[model samples]
Target: MILQSLVRLYDELSRQGKVAREGWGTAKVSHRLVLDEAGNLTGIVSARKKVLRGKKEKEIPSDMMVPLMVIRTTGVKANFLCDNSGYFLGVDKKGKPERTKECFEAARVLHHQILDGCHGAEAKAILSYFDRWHVDTARECPLIQENLEDILDGSNFLIQVGNRDATEIPEIRKAWDDYFKSAGEEGNEERGQCLITGKKDEPIAILHPKIKGVQGAQSSGANLVSFNKDKISFCSYGYDGEQGKNAPVSKEAANAYGTALNFLLADRTHAKVMGDTTVVYWSEHAKTVCQDCFLGMMGDDSGLTDKELDDILIHMKNGQSADVSGVTVSPDEPFYILGLAPNGARISVRFFLRNTFGTFIKNIAAHEERLKIVHPPWEKDWIPLWSVVKATANPHSKDSASSPLLAGSLLKAVFLDGRYPEALFQNILRRIFSDHDEPAGGGKPEMFKVSYVKAAMIKAYLLKNCGTKWEGKIQMAVNENCNDISYVLGRLFSVLENIQQSANPDINSTIKDRYFNSACATPAAVFPVLWKLANAHLGKLDQPRAVYFKKKLGLLMDKIAMPDRGTPLPHRLTLDEQGAFVLGYYQETQARYAGKKEDK
Candidate 1:
């Protein structure tokens, strides 16, 4: 019956184009079949094509492929499958193949062993023993020992018995439902709510609502009200006993008083919203005070009693203060209170105002600019160094040869920093120098001389200090610099390569003779070599030692050669006029010495 089922499944697979070539050759492919003690088939396993070797004469029954398909078809996470090769079989933590031929052959033997008995509960129990043993062997398979635990625990199994009446099993459904509902709840709670506004909505500003209350008795007092979003406006004009019994104050003072009142109202309203009660103490000549004796207060919430208010007022009155009005309250109204000064005392009221819209806007803009300046995420996507260099070299723009060099240097400092991959570095160099339309001229030679001098200096520094570890990186730097020079020259100059190889002899030897002759014969060539040596030496020394060598080299070069003029001189000679003059003197002396030796 098991063989019949296997044949039927293979036939269906062939009809669906899932199995290759429908004839006898198809069954010849090895299929990894998983079975229980009852000889019931559990799964089929296959291998992917990449792992398969030899001419594609016939596709193997892929153990890996079969399980992937089974997963899609059955919606189960408890099946096991493995390739036919012992090297790729699945196993349990104990390291044994779960579906070995020995286990299958034994189960087949047991199937016959149990067939003689009556097809009752006792026969089923005997068959179940074979199934359990098959699972145990897979868990302990030696071929997949390392991954045995994963196979046993990680893989899923599915039982698709047609007309088996599994619906009658209440325990299984309840267990499955409980597991899924717990998982669903966990997923939902992981996403939390917004904390600031206590709402799962977009960000919004918090505004304080104003309150209404009884107006004070002063004639100059006026009601305060919100005129627009985030703003409060009011007017104030009151009696001054000093001028006469009911003399009104100046319009300017009233307007100023009105403005002050608006600010005071906003402040008190905000304080109340923040759960702080306020007390207002009014003096004709003193600054405004809150209910808690908070004079010129901001953000303070400590409460004050009537006795404290009395003491504060007494102190103000002793300082020649006039009439005072005191009220203890929360920020409940848009009304203002005015105090009249008896006879000739001065009168003034002061209050805090909400920050202006323009001020807040300016603050926000400044903050945004600061954020952009500090964390510039856009810089990561900058064009490649070669592209930037080539663009800067175009004659159409106000670009020069030096522009590209500077641009390349900037790019090195900003992006590469010696960490970029080798392929990327090569790609950058190729892009920069691949297109060259200009004719090779004196400018080309001049640019080569300058670039070569700089490249040699860099090479010397790397070799003298970094040793073998620096070899690959230095070569890349040299190649990149050479590409840049090649673009400038409008043709390949093998001379730079020769100089580099001579400096590090293990490298390719193209222009070794030319480099040697130039170093021996010309001050221009020798200067770069010497400068590179000195600079490399200086870099490896202490600060004081570096300064000493730098000064000595400066003096030595000054006495040897004259500086190049009408163009930018080499970096070594450009350091100082004394150095160039010294180098010039040395060059002539060396030439005379060489001529004398030849004559001899």
Candidate 2:
């Protein structure tokens, strides 16, 4: 029987394209077969190698042609007959033929049993069973035909059952049927009483099915069903009005729709759908209803439409910005809401205000959970130089000014002279002096000069505060006249005297003579008196020295004839033609001091 099976397998392989045209050599057959004594085959096997001198040459040693015939026979016997026929199919121990009638009879009996049991089973189930049996038989067999080995390696088939054309399984179809049946029954139970008018002979049911399957099952119309308990029954389909029976929305429905729209607009996480009625579609992962949708259902339309909602939702799905403009009362204000899709983009509803009453076009910033109820007004004002200076010193200040250092320099110039770059000075002055009570004419210049003088006085006071240490430098310089300190002090005092003589007309010539003679004749004589006065003031320096300097300087100023108190100092001095007077005096005093030092 084994020999017969082997011969049948060889013929089957030749019929198939799996085997080479030239028969396998003796060596190949030997590799595939192992046998027992008494000329009875006991095992089969397969191997492959390069055919050194064949038409089909160079290839992977394992790429042997499949033994299709041998595989089919083995599969049939093991899978259908349920018996081991692989042991009796090849060369014997002594390389002779092995055959037996008894073995064939046993295989025939097993085949009959399988055929009877498996005849009516589904082809898929039968194939599955056969596949299992084939695998078991192959593993148990000690040796297999070369083609059989190839066939086993090549076959990796799967089987499917039932009608291939069916769109849904039986279970799903049954579920749909059950759901629709239950829905229908519920609709019938909730049906309202028929409305009867006086002119009508018989009452008519307000809502009746218009057409069965008029719209396909997948369409919105087919998916809709309505029920009512009131005398005036209402019916409509398509939640968004894209499809289904068209019906006018009653006041109640409108309110409901408006409420839904508000809720959808308010929801931060759910992309809003605005239509006649707002809707928030739920996803598997995002199961919560949108707060905006809930608010909309409660009747709020902050200026949104169903189409806009749909557009925003579409954008949300695509991971794009879903901001829609012109929906709210203030069009410039943005209304931020959540994106519907899993994409983390936000949907914004914007309102543009038309012809607002303020100088600036107002824009209110809003988002989900936070709405700007009142928009603050914007005002324009100049920023002070001091503010700029302070801001520059503090790194934490976020001032919008471009260059704080430049601002500070400009401010300092104005503080020192009250006449800096006109534009910057005026701007900073306006900010600082806006609240001052001083008049704007001559009073303004006077006030500005006073401010400048006050700054200088503060510097002098600070130096005086240095006490004996500060006086020692001046005393030493005066005694030794080191580095021409005597000449410098004489020059400075002469400049002050000249200014006083020009400004005041009541000065005594004797006092002027004494000041000049002491300042220039012997710088030491001027230094002792000036030093004693400065030290005395420094000893009592807790008092306001700035005020003291202003008062004392005013008392000493010569009374020069002037038009009014408000006249600018520059204008007065120019009118008097004292341009070179102070400078000439300073030069002469320095020259006198220098000559006297040379003589000493």
Candidate 3:
């Protein structure tokens, strides 16, 4: 089903003139080898394209063209009509003698094969150019040396018909197509009902191309499907090592899906690497709005402004969409989302969803609503999931990858409206226990470890369990009207901590530093002791501020009813209650800044 969706997308893309025609593959070209009608290498031209990344413009190899790669593991195997320095001229940076000689030979053989099919005068003249060709004279261009391995050995280079133009000749393309068709015939082709295309008597590719751009996969890439005898019991199924015989996929279907997926993976706007997984999305038809909006939510596209994306989301929240650049998104359009992760050589499907665009937006909007919280002034109106995940990771890295399973589960929950992964709540709690109130400064140790991102994640998790009655009570900021015992206790704890801070502004440690875990876990054990300490701290303050804070604490405490001052607290707070604790502390901190501004 995954491949089918991609195949259908490829077909639609072909119709829309966005992809190459059938039997051709898209390759990112760094430079082109320009050839004359006589097949002489006249000049080397760049195929570099410019694109804007963030606020800066940069150049990347992006002139996509049609070609088939010749992937020989160790030896030279030239492309049908295009290749990089390694295959065309054997220009290794280290100048390896054996590889250089071998690649030249491969090029010689490939051109001879092309010469054999040519009957015209141009073809014969091309053969003459090859006769006088010298591999020793071929020099590597400076562009090929930029990140040597990735450019010369890694990227695909192309062949153009002219010295400077990337345009192709009709006759050459037709001749190449004829040769390509004859070469694709695999002997002993499988004869069975194909699973994907449902055709019979068609060839099936046992080894498909390496799937690229997946995070943590093999550097060379990984396979989507394969079963070895050592790994699985049903390897051969009574056939002599005939791979992929059981789960039949026709060669046509295989190529179509592979090509389409590669197109998506190579495009940054369509693919997002979130920790262990790479997610790719597309609509079945020409719905640019759907693709852009979906990517916009995940913070993958750099072209759209934040407010523009946010406006689209807001309109979506209302079950309506505004026109965007002459194209308006409709909720009824079909959409597909696929998440893939690496498991050794084989690929793992984290999740796949097939639904209308409306359903996708609805589920996502609901999740955003759940995560709503008053953020710092510097924070963006919309938060990416990666930011939430990073708060749970070690603090040194600006871009820490979340756990693979956790990232997948969080995305699934966002798009499915299902229960969140169990690890998210537990991980947040673990961070809370180990962290302190460490405000950060230039290369200095933090004085407040509680971050807005982490607090927002805590709020989101708790709000998932918040019942309808607590709507107004559980809000973006401090909610004084809330009557929930856990929430009220959390708020009370915040006030007490603040009084300690007010009394000793320069103190290295406060009640929070010594008693935060205990305060949230077993409030009964910590609250009574903290209240006595608060009186001492308040007495150190001026008489006017002392009376004002005392009255505020007394009113908040009045809302908390207990049989007696010595009543025992619950042994430990549940996950939902833990969220309340975090939110109350976060809100209290924000209120402090607000009060200071008012005083000024």
Candidate 4:
């Protein structure tokens, strides 16, 4: 199903001239080998330019449309019109003279075979250069000697004639395309029914193109689909050790799907890396609006403005079509999202989800609604997906990464509107317990310990997955009128901490740093001690302020009614109760400082 969707996308992109044709693809060229009429090496001009990557500026190769390249592992394989210096100039930094000599010879033979009878100046100059160049004396050329270091860095090169690129010549393009069409006819290739296209007697691709840009995958690339026939379990009956034949995808279908995936991987607007997973998404009808809107919603850098995205989301919530960046996108258009993760030499499919674009938008909006909480003015109105997952990470850790598996699962749940993974909830709680005393900075007393994102996540999980126990109980802000036992205790803890902070204005540490975790887990034991401290703190306050605080404490304690067991506080709280305690504490703490300016 994934291949079928990608192939279909490739066809759509092809018709729109967004991707390469069947017999061609784009490659990164770092330099152009300038050649004269006599095929003499004249100059080596850089095909790369400096681009800003984060805070650093680095040189990146320019993308050029070139003939389709073959999948080469260690064995020698030469590409036409584009290749590293090893094949083009017969020299490299690897220091293997014999291997470099073989590379040059292979390129020479392949170019000669394709351009043998062509009379075009581009083709003739290319052939003449190959016949005249010598691997042993390549360094003798002043141009090659000057640029040897850069060329040997494995940067690709393209041939440039007087006013045009050699690859752009009509005759050479036709010759190369013709060669590509018939190259599969060579007897060495295995023929079978294509699993992707279902065409019989077609040449199957022994090796599919490499998928790049996936985090932690091979620097060169990794295979999304591959079969190891050496392992008997991977090979079917009668297939023997014919690797690709076991699942037979025709060379054309393989290239098509690969082209589509590579196109998405290369473009930022179509892909995003969350943790170790790289997510690529596309729309069925080839609309840029869908891509832009989706990326904007996921908090990726997109072309849409905040207002534009908000309007689109509002339309989606109303079940109406939206004009995104001046393009009207129907809600019924199919949208596909693919999650790819690195697994050694192969790419693992974390998820492949297909749904109406509107459905996805609605699911995202619903996720936002469920996570609604009273946030500080500094926080954005809508929390991004990355921020939600990042809440699970320990802020003090050097590598701020959550579980990769949990990241993927959390995204899938949000898109499908399913129950969030249990790990997400547990990890958030774990982070809260470990980071109990950490402050959100800016000298705000309410910003300590539990963050807004973590509190929101806990609230969302409990409301949706924890049944009717918490139904109609949780709210975006403090619920002053109502009281659950765990909640009242949590609110009381915040008031006690506030009293301590008020009494000792210069104190850096409060009871939260010492007793928050214990108070949350076993409120009965800690709250009594906190109450004794609160009384001493009250004595330090003025008469009016003391009376006000006492009244406030009495009101909250009155709400915690005693049951038949005659105990105001339970011995210990369960996991769900602990979450509610955190929520109550967060809400009440925010309430204490509501509408107040922070101390400068």
Task: Kindly report which residue stretches of model 1 are placed more than 4 angstroms away from their true locations once superposed.
Answer: 1-43, 48-386, 389-600
Best by TM-score: 4
In angstroms, the error of model 1 at 429 is 20
Query: Candidates ranked by lDDT, best first?
Result: 4, 3, 1, 2
Q: Which stretches of candidate 2 lie over 4 Å from their true place?
A: 1-175, 178-188, 192-600
lDDT (Cα) of model 3: 0.72
Quote model 3's TM-score: 0.75
Per residue, candidate 2 scores C-alpha lDDT tens digits across 1-600 of 211222233333334432232212111122222222221223333334455567667422232232112234422232121122332222122222223233333333433343333332332232333323332244344444534545343222111123221112233223323433343343333222212112222222224222111111222221112333233334334323311123322222222222333333344334322211112322111213222322332224424465654564444434454444632222122222211111112112121111221101111100110111111123112122233332222222364332422442332232222223333322332232222213357433212211221222222221233234333322211222212233244334543443344334465542234444334344444545654444444444335643554444343232222347653122222201121222223344444456557889
lDDT of 1: 0.30
- The TM-score of candidate 4 is 0.76
Model 3 pairs whose backbones collide: 38-126, 437-447, 437-448, 438-446, 438-447, 438-448, 438-449, 439-447, 439-448
Cα deviation at 393, candidate 4, in Å, is 1.8
lDDT of 1 by residue, 61-121 (tens): 3321222211234221221122222222223233444434443444345333423343543
Model 4 worst lDDT window (10 residues): 439-448
Off by over 4 Å in 4: 25-179, 439-448, 564-566, 598-600
**lDDT scores in order:** 0.30, 0.29, 0.72, 0.87
Model 3: ten consecutive residues of lowest lDDT: 162-171
lDDT of 4: 0.87
